[model samples]
Target: MEERNRSASLRRALTVLDHVRAHPGLTLTQLAEAVGLSKSTVLRLTAPLIEAGLLDRDRDSGLYRLGHGALRLGQAYLDTLDLRAVAAEESHRLMAEVGETVHLVVPDHPHVVYIDKVENEASVRMASRIGSRGPVHCTAVGKAILAWQPAELLTGLVLEPRTRHTITDVERLRAELAQIRRRGYAVDDRENEPEVRCVAAPIFDHQDAVAAAVSVSGLTSRITAARVRELGPLVAAAAARISSKLGSTTR
Candidate 1:
């Protein structure tokens, strides 16, 4: 009986997640009605999910939406599959060819998170950890992903001022994103770290959306302005090849 009850609860949780995925901005009342449960029961079930960060509640509107934790979990599940693993090999190759640290980053919440990385044997080491979060406005991988983001997603981002080098001006950031799109790559010239530089390009999915970014990073001395320019196209080409392997046809 206990096992059956647990199974039923799991099914109900899945149903709630599916419903939220279909209708992102759902009120508690609406969710309760749709799930065929009382308001109190629905709230109780959703409490753990909210605590786990799988769902979020809008304070002003009193609506529940899918949260960053859910997206991170979904991305992690995808990474464990064949696609991200295959991309990792390409990232490793790029690191080897460029003699720099190559990172694979994905958008999460208001920041970008490094999912995988490969470091060149001869390159100056970076301070980045596998699960480290980076600012979107000042990082090559972040700019690469932002350049290909939908307008709606761009609007939803909140640009906080973290450092003097951070791009806080909205119009200027947009212009920079535009340049990134046109150039097919992005360069972070010590924007995030004072003595580090990086060049990055977008990785697309089958749907041609910017699913991730690949970047090659090194110290400022090794990756000078001219070297950044030279490596930009190389990173972009590598990213494009990986995107093609993932069945992306659109630029």
Candidate 2:
């Protein structure tokens, strides 16, 4: 009986939350009617949620709505939706077009983490490991996201140097990001690894926020300065195509 009551309570809580999410700012009475629960039961259920910050009630208007805690939980769920699997076809197409290794990366604060890759036929392969972190200040994948982060977060990064050419100065990095924004792409320019270069472009979600990025990387011996210029637009195109598939209405 105790276990059955607990399960019923949990189901009720979830149903109440789902109702609140679907109809934001509903009153206590409105929620009770929507979920077919008694007003007293809703009061009991919402008390714990209000304490946990998952739900909030407006004292002035006497309405209930999801809070910051709920938003965090929703975002966590969205983050786990396999972006690599979502981007697989686009990554393969890009690999075929550029003949270089392609990476799918997401920002991990001070680093960018590789979630997936499409490898090239070349014998000299990129040293990147899937699920490994790379510096945000120098890697093309990192630069692409850095260029899209909020100004306060972008300015506060430590800009740790990985190579001689790595942009350690805030002003220099800001300038580089400006160029990236204008061109819709970013480049490593041998900053992450000796004799290696890469071009990358941001992938935006339906909210028009940079969610992740796609990068084309190769040995600098074959991926020359001229080749970088050529592949830059192609990378941006691939990223845009992937973003569209991910529900971005942006062209």
Specify the highest-TM-score model's number: 2
Off by over 4 Å in 2: 1-81
True-vs-predicted CA distance for residue 129, candidate 2, Å: 0.6
RMSD of candidates 1 onward, in order: 12.9, 8.9
lDDT of each: 0.85, 0.88
Cα lDDT tens digits, model 1, 78-139, are: 56656568687788788878899999888884689998888876757788999899988788
Tens digit of per-residue lDDT, candidate 2, span 1-251? 99999999989998998789779989888889999999999999989888888999998998998988987876776677667877999999999987999999998988889999889876477888899999888999998998988867665688776778788888888899999999999999988787899999999986888989999988888799999999999999999988986667666
lDDT of 1 at 60: 100
Tell how far residue 182 is off in model 2, in angstroms. 0.4
Worst-scoring 10-residue span by lDDT in model 1: 77-86
Model 1 / residue 97 / CA error / Å: 1.3
lDDT of 2: 0.88
Error of 2 at 165 (Å): 1.0
Q: List TM-scores for all candidates, in order.
A: 0.65, 0.67
